[model samples]
Target chain A: LAKTTQPISMDSYEGQEVNITCSHNNIATNDYITWYQQFPSQGPRFIIQGYKTKVTNEVASLFIPADRKSSTLSLPRVSLSDTAVYYCLIGGATNKLIFGTGTLLAVQP
Target chain B: SQTIHQWPATLVQPVGSPLSLECTVEGTSNPNLYWYRQAAGRGLQLLFYSVGIGQISSEVPQNLSASRPQDRQFILSSKKLLLSDSGFYLCAWSLGRVEEKLFFGSGTQLSVL
Candidate 1:
């Protein structure tokens, strides 16, 4: 499994765009970048996923550079409801994941 | 549309007691099921996964075991519970698609004393 590193915590105010980056220097070609949001007591919810370049949805966007060694999760117009733990995961052929401690984003009103 | 159901919502068990947690998925067929544990203020730990009925793969070895009696039913069991077993247990399911997202149950909070 490829290990991922992310910030422990980040802060943002309402109406701001928040970008969280994850570093997976040893990512493989088959690995796809996926992001998930987790609330305090709930299970993780998928935000977005991308193979390369950029992929955007109503909730968030995923940017994977050509090198694929790192990926960024971009959230626009942040709100207090968006405050949660964001996890960057590498999904591949095996469909297995090794989750590291995720980045906690605290959105202020 | 798929939904996952996990029970007891909350449980309290004494150390050395046996444990059982059940999970089921609906509105989908032949989906892959998973069991995960999350400690307070921590990330999730994948405990078990099932690809099909009666097939289970465990990520870590401890006092826990899993059984998939039916295609959509996954169960986590323990012969003797330890204090370390206290945590939030979650059940999830995903499409067989390699890149698909996982849909999770509400969750179960297990307290071992």
Candidate 2:
């Protein structure tokens, strides 16, 4: 499984955009980058996923560079309700899915 | 319209006691089910996974054991609980073939005192 590295925490204001980047230098060719949003006391929810380039969904957008070594999760128009821990995971099946300490985005008023 | 359900939202068990956690999926058949544990301020650890009924694969060898009694039901059990077992346990399901996005259920929070 590929290990991901992300910032410990980030602060964003309401109505502003937030971008959390994850680095997976050893990402496999068949690996897909997936981002999940986890609120305290509940299960994590799938936000977006992408193999390469960029993919957008109703909730968020994922931008993957050509190398695929790193991907960025962009959240547009942040709100207080959006404040939660965001996890970036790589290599879903070939190896067991491992979660790393994610970027804790605190949306401020 | 698939949904996963996990029970015992919160559990407090004493050391050396028995433990059982149940997870069930509706609207999907023969899905891959998994058991994961999340520690405080840490990431999720894959404890067990099952591809089919009576088929189980364990990622970490420890006090916990998982069983898939039916196509859509998975259970986590322990003969004797340990204080170290306190954490958030999550159950998830995905398509059986290969790399599919996993759908998670409401997790169970276990506190062993």
Candidate 3:
């Protein structure tokens, strides 16, 4: 499993865009970048996943740089209900899925 | 669509008591099941995983044990509970492989006194 590093916490207001970056310097070729959003007292929900370049979905977008060393999760027009912990995981079929201390996003009014 | 059911939603047990938490998946078969524990203000820790019926893999050496008796039923048990076992337990399942996206249950909050 590739170790990931992210900001401990971030602050955002309603209608603002929030981008959380995760650094995985030793990412493997077969590993994929996946992001999950977890509200308090609930299971983490899948937000977006990408192998490379950019992938957009109904909820969020994932941007993977050419070097694959890092990826960013972009959430547009944040709201108070969007406050949650965001996790960035990098793994392949043969690797163990480990969830590290994720970035806590506080969406204020 | 698939759904996972886990119970009891909240449990408060004595330290020396035995423990059993059941989790079942509906609308899917031959799925990979996993048990994870999360302490307050901490990340998730994978405790056990099962690939098929009667086949289980333990990720951590602890007081808890898991069993897969049927295709869609996963059970977590302990002969004697410990205070350290108190945490939020989550059960998840994936369609085919471990690396695939997972669907998680509502989770159980366990407190051992």
Interface RMSD of each: 1.3, 2.1, 2.1
Which is superior by DockQ, 1 or 3?
Answer: 1
* Docking quality level of the chain pair in candidate 2: medium
Name the runs in model 3 displaced over 4 angstroms: none
**Which parts of model 2 have CA positions greater than 4 angstroms off?**
A92-95, B97-99
TM-score of chain B of 2: 0.97
Using alpha carbons, what is the TM-score of model 2?
A: 0.95
TM-score of each: 0.97, 0.95, 0.95
Candidate 2 structure quality by residue, lDDT tens digits, B34-111: 899998877788899898899999999999999998899999999999999999999998775445577899999999
Q: Mark the regions of model 1 whose C-alpha exceeds 4 Å error after superposition.
A: none
Clashing pairs in 3: none
Error of 1 at B74 (Å): 0.3
Select the stronger candidate by lDDT from 1 and 2.
1
Chain B TM-score, candidates in order:
0.97, 0.97, 0.97
Q: State which candidate has the highest lDDT.
A: 1
**Where is model 3 chain B poorest over a 10-residue stretch in terms of lDDT?**
B94-103
Native-structure RMSD, model 1: 1.0
What's the lDDT for candidate 3?
Answer: 0.90
TM-score of the A-chain for all models: 0.96, 0.97, 0.97
Q: Which model scores highest in TM-score? A: 1
